[model samples]
Target: MHILILGAAGMVGRKLLARLAQDGQLGGTAVTRLTLHDVVAPEAPPVRVPVSLSASDFSAPGEAERLVAGRPDVIFHLAAIVSGEAEADFDKGYRINLDGTRQLFDAVRAIGEGYRPRLVFTSSIAVFGAPMPEPIGDEYLTAPLTSYGTQKAIGELLLSDYTRRGIFDGVGIRLPTICVRPGKPNKAASGFFSGIIREPLAGQEAVLPVSDSVRHWHASPRAAVGFLLHAATIDGARLGDRRNLTMPGVAVTVAEQIEALRRIAGDAVVARIRREPDPTIERIVAGWPRAFDARRATELGFTAEPDFETIIRAHIEDELGGRIAA
Candidate 1:
């Protein structure tokens, strides 16, 4: 099987690439060729499979057409402007998030003669806005409060419509806030979700923007990669008309996350989390869905970490070299 990964330079995309490289296959078929594309050149990883790396803006005129020329069997679209960045810059967000996705989808459809490939899109839980139920269900409507969410919701719709038209087999997974994300914090409004746990575990002081009682859905980076793999290989026929799925995740509050950190890394690590509220971040986070039913994704065989503690432990083992600061 030939695979193409867009946004291969990002965190989730990088992890997905690593998993694919390590396994050397997808859906039980060996990946013979892999193409990695991003706005900036993605560093090529040494892999047994033949790999091609390119840097281009897919939203730009004619770029998407060039990307789909290779006719990959499986296409993973994981590119998008992050929440805070999207909210701050309107034109850049719409151009990259909305236009970029449409350009890619249209390019695929333009490729005639039964060239339908399995397309996996990484969406965000931010697609659902405020006034939401305690545990948002699979049936909840997409009422995005942020530009980033709006773009993802639009992409989900396009995926469904295109799939229904038999242009391609598409699956969109609405991922939860990935907790304990490795590396330094980025510009995402949700970065604090991971920062609170990741930084403190490194013996570095971290800021908590939201209150301790604020609840949200979370998954580990490991679980995020698993979701992508499952989406790529799952039987799309079972999805029916609704091609978008809210992935399974653990629901917990800030206090619960800190407790998990304390449990795994001791009180010293937990003490590093300083509560310094940022109204801007708090307002943005308040509009996000606190939890999710995700029964559809669960029944479809997608699973996540059961609790916040497991998420922290996974971070320690994977990124911290199986050790935390003493």
Candidate 2:
């Protein structure tokens, strides 16, 4: 099958690419061609798979058409302006996150007859605003606290409506805070979540922007990739009219994360972290969902990290080669 990945250069996109390249298949079916697109070119996999790379902003006029022209069997829409970046730059955020998504969906709608492709969109937990109950459920209302969340929630609504209209088979997976993400940080308010663990394991000092008691929902990069792969092949008929689902992830406090760190890498590694609260970050984080009752996703076969320790172990294995004594 032909697979197209947008924003293929980003961290999640790159990981998904690597996973696909290594497996050489999707949903147990052999992949024929892989088309990758991003504003920044992703690292070309040194694999024998037939892969093509393109550098183009999907929001650009005609770019979406070009991308959807071939009518790929699966399209992974992973491109977007992140939380802090989106809230910081309103124009850039709406331009890419909202308008860009619309362009892609429009392109899909304009396709010829019998073109029902699986459009797997990567949304975020930011879609839910504050004043929420302890654990958010699949039926939680979306009252985004930031422009970024609003954009994502809007995209989810669009995906649902479009799917209802039979324009395409779309699945919007509202992802949690991806912890222990590999590589450098992005502008997400949740970046510090990954930074604290990743940097400490790399033998570098990292800052914790909030109190240890700050609770949040989280998942591993491996789990996030699993969600994408599952969405790519899962039967949309099972999803019905609800095009979006809250993905399953571990819910823990920052204190638990530190405890998990001390357990896996000793107190010395945990000591690498310095506590310096940034109220700006804390305020933004306060509006996010503390936990999600993702029973729908769980029932649908979506799995998450067993605990904070599992999250860290997955990171150490995938990003640090199972060695953290550096």
List the candidates' TM-scores in order.
0.98, 0.97
lDDT of 1 by residue, 1-326 (tens): 99999999999999999999899889899989999999999977778778889998889999889989999999999988999999999999999999999999999999986799999999999999999988898878999999999999999999999999999999999999988789889899999989988888788999998899999999998999999999999998788899999999999998898888888888988889899999999999989999999999999999999888889889999998998976
What global local distance difference test value does model 1 have? 0.92
Model 1 misplaced regions, further than 4 Å: none
Put down candidate 2 lDDT per residue, 45-124, tens digits, no spaces: 86776778899788999999998888889999999999999988999999999999999999999985799899999999
TM-score of 2: 0.97
- Model 2: per-residue Cα lDDT at residue 173: 98
Q: Name the candidate that leads on TM-score.
A: 1
lDDT of 2: 0.91
Model 1 earns a TM-score of 0.98
Model 1 root-mean-square deviation: 0.9
What lDDT does each candidate get?
Answer: 0.92, 0.91
